[model samples]
Target chain A: MPLLSALGGATWRLSGHLARHFSQTARRGERPGGEELSRLRLDDLAPTALSAGRLELLFGLSPCLLALRAARRRVARLLLQAGKSGVQGERAELLRAAEVRGIPVLRPRRQKLDALCRHQVHQGVCMEVSPLRPRPWTEAGEAKPGDDPQQLWLILEGLQDPRNLGAVLRSAYFLGVDKVITSRRNSCLLTPVVSKASAGAMEVMDVFFTDHLAGLLQAKTQQGWLVAGTVGCPRPEIPGSSEIPITSCLEFLWDQPTLLVLGNEGSGLSPEVQASCQLLLSILPGRQLPPGLESLNVSVAAGILLHSICSQRKGFPEEKKRGQHL
Target chain B: MPLLSALGGATWRLSGHLARHFSQTARRGERPGGEELSRLRLDDLAPTALSAGRLELLFGLSPCLLALRAARRRVARLLLQAGKSGVQGERAELLRAAEVRGIPVLRPRRQKLDALCRHQVHQGVCMEVSPLRPRPWTEAGEAKPGDDPQQLWLILEGLQDPRNLGAVLRSAYFLGVDKVITSRRNSCLLTPVVSKASAGAMEVMDVFFTDHLAGLLQAKTQQGWLVAGTVGCPRPEIPGSSEIPITSCLEFLWDQPTLLVLGNEGSGLSPEVQASCQLLLSILPGRQLPPGLESLNVSVAAGILLHSICSQRKGFPEEKKRGQHL
Candidate 1:
């Protein structure tokens, strides 16, 4: 039955006028963009934010063997909530895979699916978690460049929006960034909204929170990391200037570690941090790389800069060899 | 007075819980995302489909702007009055820009923003725009090797989410990609939702649409352009491989044209497009790369790719000669 009809008492005709009215009311309440979630009670939800820390996702349309192919140690259980008209065909294969993983097969009630993810879009299955064993910063340093090459890490200063925070994480992960050091205040901690927004990139990132961002940059610079702050104002040419192999500059790591610092959404980098930067880069948009439009969202700007650095190092020798030899 | 105060007189607290339940009932006759707007007769408001002929946007914020902006020649405004508010600040700028260029902005006010945009948040501003203006496929040939390029463009395939669409445009403009192009069917066109998501790039970009994407790709390829696509499955050994400096490979397009094509959100580069590609590369996430996450949103992916290409070209002598070099 259509959700619309279920709520009505009598057979109501959806006169175009009435439908028009209904839609307008709905639109007013809707927030612009993806943050329009109706809040759910933390208690009723079987998954607490605390417990969710241990979870891994098994999401896809039916037939892809991603969930079922996981090793036992890697997965804990499979969850399906597709009622009597339950999962069939490829989705069944996924269930079998979960069984093989020795993961429990849990079937949630249909209403529960609505409860799990506010929107009724969780197609059939989800997974109970197998905790991700915590790792230390040194272990997280796997992203560091070898051969005395330069590497890039990002320091996020006071990002408030969860979606923006999530976007930065996703950008950092895909762009070969080493790690992200974020400020504890006025920042969104990793949450479900962050997870969903990141589209599953939340798993491998190394995010640590600290009190002072400026101090961290200073300390890292002392340890041989070239710290560059993304500034709002114009400045000198970035390191290596003309013919500066961006990829090489990014991978340069200056025999020292490298840290790229970003600031708040509305405000650009903090004055203190800007003063501390070895190179204050204003990623201009054109030939005379201009200052950003009155303001550029921090996360969006971060993606632009990170991509620049990571892209420089995109296909080192081997891939080129493969492209050439293949 | 706050909108909530008006509701309090009706015996309801304005808390989210009450709002949620109230929404369920009051929304029975309401639209999906906003307030119930009064519908105006067709005779009262003149409207069209897309201001650009490529998108179908619902202008429901300020109808006056709709009247002012949707008067372009090629633009057709479809008013979603089924309760519609016309245009907002920056988006109005696009429609207004189109109007200035003699493109007609349409104003059909019967449809609601929700109906036109499904459940996506259009912010009461929707547009039916022509595809972004396509650049001559031959333009890439103008860029020389080692010349810090003056202008850059980004080409994408199959990016779906409007937010990603908006974000990519936002980053592209901020980072300096002058234009953007994508397949008509697989890509989301510039709608009011996209304009809002873009923060303002929708107005700045020369976005173009094409029904036959392969033809566009073929045209560019024939123009001596090097097209690279990002592929990160099996998580390559050489992450960020596509970013390295290949003076040898780039020399081919140093004075020629270049186009970096990003594949779909999840399944990047269709096999067909990949086969047609000059290079298939991947951005290595370093050790910080997430375990199961496949990729970043398409626009973000493009941001990373375009930034790398542009940054690399900056190192060349030609780019520096063009102007005050960064």
Candidate 2:
């Protein structure tokens, strides 16, 4: 409700002026000259827009086209590189989508596009759209006990990097995770950078957010869901750490519904999250790693872990099909 | 030999003038102010140093420290952000390594460091070192027919992005791929950007390059090596594609020494490379994918594929151990 209220307020304010300009430009069939729009800033138009926080400027060909196709966000305007009006294929498809939707298509100079995206690769396309708000976990319908036992939900705890979060979401979606839930606090909110990094996967995926991740895990456990927390490696060196049995991801069998928790980049799972987990999963290095090279990047690790667990599900190819049936 | 010759020539030339200034500054205990060093460019010092092609500017604490410790390249100088000289921990360790090796240390403005790395994240530390040259594949020793049956070598064919190349290398090294081979023709070279992206794994991993990747695969196939090439999916729609047996990566058994070949980001394996592969492996998506989201990122795919194949090796933990033995 807070997310919806905030988004509604921001969108209402933004659409008042910017949306009017966009529709007028489209109706007049006038392309805004680069010089005329050089000093235009989306934040300036929306006074409360906190530097890419309130209104999102999604860029790149995939993110732009997918954002339009998904229709998840309220797109205000579409900006294509000035000389790319005649562009075919995906860019053309994007133009047609905007036309059909009556969204203004602005052919801005590449510099304006570049400045708009802060020099991130725009692929000659940028979109001014309402921020895609992640729904609160309370709004996510709970899976019944009789629901698919092979379901897997990815729980990300305190992931700070947008690119890492984006990559993780891409992998989670591609691997067919039943759901992706992240701690709302201290986690990277859905952003343009995340969208671009995800190759536009963020546009399509419905990610749920919750402040009480540990409580959610505990509740799910009572509903016959396995809570699996990821650790870089088992550390027996720390006293009393051996209480939680660590299973190598390859050795762990996926036989039931599960919530797989991934930790932040610098630190592993928090104590509360770790305490709620029934199992600890680790990816064993193939060989002895040198100091400082011991851990894989958080995103890479997520991809590996997701693949390992998801591939073992009942949906995999016949050869990998196990005794467990749906 | 070409790689070595190029590296030797560049190192010798860099050591003449720039190396002297670094040592003199270190010896005199004088810090060059930002204004005096603002216009200095590594390329300006060496006229032929084609913008980060010859002399490498390795950055970030891990890559710098590992490069120094690896002793794989000639360390010319170390650059730490101004006022960070008295820092402790990893930065201090880097300073010590430079001091012990008589590699002069320079304290430059953050802007200078940013410019040197093309605004890439340098983590307040940068190093001027001879490029770590990847040896030609021909220089790599031939693996005999009776070599370890569990050996897995990652072969990359024409990966274009340095970040992708770096990520793959980091995974390869972390997952314990016996060797990493790439086509020298179109593959991203071993650059500092790669080093930083790899999180310093590039400093320790020796990547072998060859012009004729297909010919090498053919040669390895003759040596009782199973050549496994990756495809996005089995496309029975493509005429005559059914002839190449494409197995799900989960179902593929790693019974012998294998060469896993990953292709370029855009277009996968070339016909020549595909023809040389005895088996095609694909990661099966968990569900029906929407259009434009069918394929995983090349780097992400590599991680998943590598994890799937590597985890099945005989060296895995007891639970994952199979009948195959050393």
Candidate 3:
């Protein structure tokens, strides 16, 4: 009944002022050039953040069986909830995938599934996927020179929140970032909370895990990617220290291949990582910021910065055109 | 030991490279052009997110006691965990505030505090404060005829996540918004989770809650405020309808007192709200978004829009000034 009401509401709105609003013009169907759409479906089964330590549980029939079939990581087992709606399609597909992988499948009552996940909401279907392992840079073939200089690479220094990780990844993937490099030592490890927060972008993004961030940054800097890092501290004035150039996020230019770095939530940058950055970028303070409330949430900051760079790179001209429409 | 370790780490880091960074510039002895610094300590008692009914629990010594003393809302009770350190100032202050208000203060074991909040971290202090009640629009002086036309107002419709609510409020407050308006029917209440997520912004922000959002919007429109709303679907193909101007968020002007409305996390503006908006704004899409992921997280999208408008209103002389620094 609720779903019916929601759809009814959506339809009613679509026929009214929204109809006029959306009829302004046509949007170009072409995705501004990247991988072929053919491989888009292959990433629907990302598994890194779902399982924390050992076997992880994935709920919902489509996400589980899809992950079993398409995830880069392997599945160890499947746990299907007994007696639920819309199981035949995923059940058949799940059985086929399990047979192909030689994995085990178990049918468990809903209550049992609830017990295993500490009373988390597991929507009918669940799977025991392999534990998360950090992906090596070598797996993506970007380390030994000749990598695309224009490729966007982000180095996250010490993000703490799992939800922030998911949000940033979704934005990064949407904005055409090539890959992400993060360290687990001073950051949130990929977990189920992160996967759910990502709303499925975790399945598609290319993330390389690292322990030696400063060292890798030095290497990347040596390779001539314009190394930039974000800082929120309003200008720390060192009497004798030379000023490094800082770019406002609004006016930042993407003239070269870039490696953008973000600092921890509370602490902006570790001294070592701060030393590695050649360019400092900032979201610039707006008027009347409440004390102790100056900086934005880490994930929100990421979305804004990624949007700025991505739009510039695409040469997407909309502001003036949109102004004209107004 | 954990508290000692956390403080030790904070102090140690505070003196190192962080010292050099902070010592570079001295903060203004005054908190800019706002209230006197003498009253700054009053709001330190905000509770962490916990309550959904009549009262909520605020954890940590400073936030709980200070909230008890200074919050416009009443504190029903204070829960003090036995066997914790650093209670001299806040404890003394808390007891005084409770006596003045005739509220009870309970000294409970740490286990009891944990149980009360469903196993949330309490940091040895907790308080039950009054539940949220709708604030009348008259409190902020916006409902009057001669209110400042340059004041900024916001309307949020059907936001579901307490975290997003908190994040948006923090950003809105930091960016100099005058007040916020939200409806409760399809929205997350001002619960303890939201308070924690907001990092205490909820205590200070001037939020006017409304039951009849459409009616209030209509009234505000009649009173002459430039009203706008955001949509993310990116579909510009509703047939048989005439064109309506859509402003890209980047170029949207903040020339007058404005009321910006953001809709539901998933479904976006109900048709009624869409009809009410004189202008429509969108966070422009970047290239090659994942098949199922096009929109950014709500809080992130809010941060970007609020930043844009706030910076514009401030007329921050950036482009060349920042370019030169670059």
Against the true structure, whose lDDT is highest? 2
TM-score for candidate 1, residues paired by index: 0.58
Q: Give the per-residue lDDT of model 2 (tens digit) for B44-99.
A: 33322322334656778889989989999877678888875577988878878888
**Chain A only, candidate 1, TM-score:** 0.59
Model 3 per-residue lDDT tens digits across residues A1-326: 21112111111111223222223311433221122323322111112222232344455443464366556656755766667664566577777888888766656667666654445445666665653445865565554335443467888887877778878887787667878888757777665545556665666567887777888778877877777888665445532112556778777778677888988877777777777777777776655453455677788888878877776764554223443223
RMSD of each: 13.3, 7.5, 16.7
Clash pairs detected, candidate 2: none
Could you give candidate 1's per-residue lDDT for residues B94-152 as a string of tens digits?
55565566644333333433444443444455444433334444443445434533445
Per-residue accuracy of model 2 over A1-326 as CA lDDT, tens digit each:
22122221122234444555655765686544332555554333322232233465678998888899899987777888888657788987998999999886767788777766656678898887877878998887888757787888899999987778878888888888888889988888788778877889999987999989989998898989888988886655545455667777777788788889999987778877887778788777887787777778788889888888887887474333221100
Which portion of correct inter-chain contacts appears in model 2?
A: 0.37
Q: Which stretches of candidate 2 lie over 4 Å from their true place?
A: A1-54, A81-92, A109-115, A235-240, A318-326, B1-54, B81-93, B107-120, B235-240, B318-326
DockQ winner among the candidates? 2
- State the lDDT of candidate 3 residue by residue for B1-326, as single tens digits: 21122211111112233333323322434322133323312121121211222334555554464355447666756767666674676576767778887776666667666655445455677776665444866565754435554567888998887778878887787667778988767887776656556656777677887777777778887987777777665435532111445777777877667888898877777777776777777777656453346677888888877777777765663323433223
Q: Model 1 chain A, poorest ten-residue lDDT window?
A: A3-12
What is the number of backbone collisions in each predicted candidate, taken in the order shown?
107, 0, 11
Task: Report lDDT per candidate.
Answer: 0.50, 0.75, 0.62
* Residues A1-326, model 1: lDDT tens digits: 22223111111123344444445645687422222123322121223222233343333332124323433225544557646465567577767776665555655565654544444234555554443222323344443334445577788777766567767877787666767777766666554445445554555556776776677677666766677766544323433232211222232233445677787876656566666666644454433322224334566667766765655553432233334311
